[model samples]
Target: MKAIRIDEFVRDLATLSPKDVPSPKPKGPRDIGVQITHAALTHVDMLYAQGLHQNNGRHVKPPFILGNEFAGIVTSAPPSSSLRPGTRVFGATLGSFAEHIYADENGLREVPKQWTNAEACAVGASGAISWGSLVSVANLKRGETALILGASGGLGVMAVQIAKALGAKVIAVVGDEEKARMIKSTGADGVVDYHEKDWENKVKAMTEDGQGVHVVYDAIGAVESGLRCLRYRGRLVIVGFAAREGKMENIQANRILLKSAMVHGYRFGEDGRQDPTRTEEVWNGFMDLVVKESIKPIIYKKNYVGLESVSQALIDLGKHTVWGRAIVRINEEAERELKARL
Candidate 1:
């Protein structure tokens, strides 16, 4: 089996390389082994490589595999589990950029019949986060309005479609006109270019009666301005800080106090630990959307081939040059099988 190994916490993507590692197997009856086809890259993977979590008391040391989510075929599974050998599945895991991965039955879900492995893999982390924030955390309702900041990026794009699927009027905030057009095509009612000075005001104006939106799904972490775009008692779901340095702007406490608003922070990994049931529900809801063709992952079309390309994928994600999500094709045989079926 081949895996991308990060021998040390270095600033350079050159540290990640393909190495032959022993294949992982199921540890127990509830565990399953998967033959990976595609692995998706996000800013979190880059943060892991740069040791961002290490300073914050996270035990992120070296000589470890470097991917967070994958889609693949089940090679081995216990008879007791619903997933059997040859089942196509996708889900989030700690280290998935490898030929084989071991996961518990609960962590994996069967992919839809229509989706290819690359599309399935593209949805894992971003899909879970989007569903968790809008459906589980915000309890977003139909006919309500949502303002999604950084709406051009991976998580933001998913949030746009999910919010729209939930029957909400979506206001997508992007950095430029091209992104604006792209998000507008995803069913957003309005697109606000955040690069403009009065972007928040524009969002407010687009809402009913200029009151503001029912929820602010902010992934850009522009909390101060995001608050200005919220209606009275609106919920602000903090998804990520991909735009800035992850340092939130100082917000006036009175803003939330006066508006009677609630601030909620969503972390996909933490949600699994805090409320495993809710996490599973979110994944299931996403799968349901897939089954209904209500949502499809917005994947970057460029093919990043093999373990050696993982570093380049990370670099593109860090630079924000890649739109939507980045996927690394790992298994040629699995890829062939997927294409044949399609």
Candidate 2:
């Protein structure tokens, strides 16, 4: 089978390339073999490729495959598992950017009949993260206000739709006028251009009585600035550090205390690993929304086809040049299946 692996930590994207590797077989009673169809490009893949997340304890230094979420058909499954051979599924797995990979039955879910593998792959992890953060972590309620930073990124776009689905009025913060327009298309109540000096003020003004938002979805790592847009007792859910890396420093305790607000950090995969059942609930919930037409993932216009294109996809991800999600078509059959559905 073919896979993209990071043999060593190199600064350049050119360090990544396609290589032939032995296809993995199910090694556990709960494991199933997946003939992967589509893999989504993620910032985590970029960080891991450059060896930036080594000390995080969740991942080790590489010579490892490069994808986290994928949609595929089942080639092999344990007799005891509910999933059978030929089941169409989407889920998270290490080394997902390959022709074949093994994932536990617990992580895989049957994809809906109406969805293409590319659509499923695009929404898989990002939907889980958004649903987990909004519905699980923040407990966002109808009629509440949410200010979503980085509202045009892969996860951000999902966050916007999820927030709106939950009946929260959204104030989307994007990098420029173009992204603002893109986010506005999702029915956000207001859009703030972060490039503007008074963007925070703009967010505050958009909220009820200028009281600020009821929740802050801080993917941008602008926690301090995000705090400025919080309502009393508001929850700040930290899902990523797309804007900057490293721990937030010198934050005054009074900033949190004065607002009587709660600041929480969430890592979707880590949370899912610790509580598999809840993760399944989130995945199913998001899929239900998809089937019901309450929400939809915004896939980027560009297609990163095949394993060989993954390196450039990762580079574009790191540069923040691409919006929504990057879909990588891995198998010819999967591509044909998706097209046939359309």
What tens-digit string does per-residue lDDT give for candidate 1 at 1-342?
789866777678766778888777667678888989989987767877777753223555676777879999988888788898888999787678888899888888888778888888877768778988998889899999999988888898899999998999999988777677778887889998777887788899998889999999988778888889999999999988886643456789899998899999998777787889988888888777777888777788678999889888887777776767788988858768755785
- Every model's TM-score: 0.92, 0.93
Query: What local lDDT score does residue 162 receive in model 2, on the 0 to 100 scale?
Result: 90
- The parts of candidate 2 lying over 4 Å away from their true place are 54-58, 245-250, 335-342
| lDDT over C-alpha atoms for residue 80 of model 2 | 90
* Clashing residue pairs in candidate 2 (N, C-alpha, C atoms within 3 angstroms): none
Tens-digit lDDT string for candidate 2 (4-115): 8767876898668889987787778899988899899877677777777643355656678888889998888888988888778998887898999999887888877777
Query: lDDT scores for all predictions?
Result: 0.83, 0.83
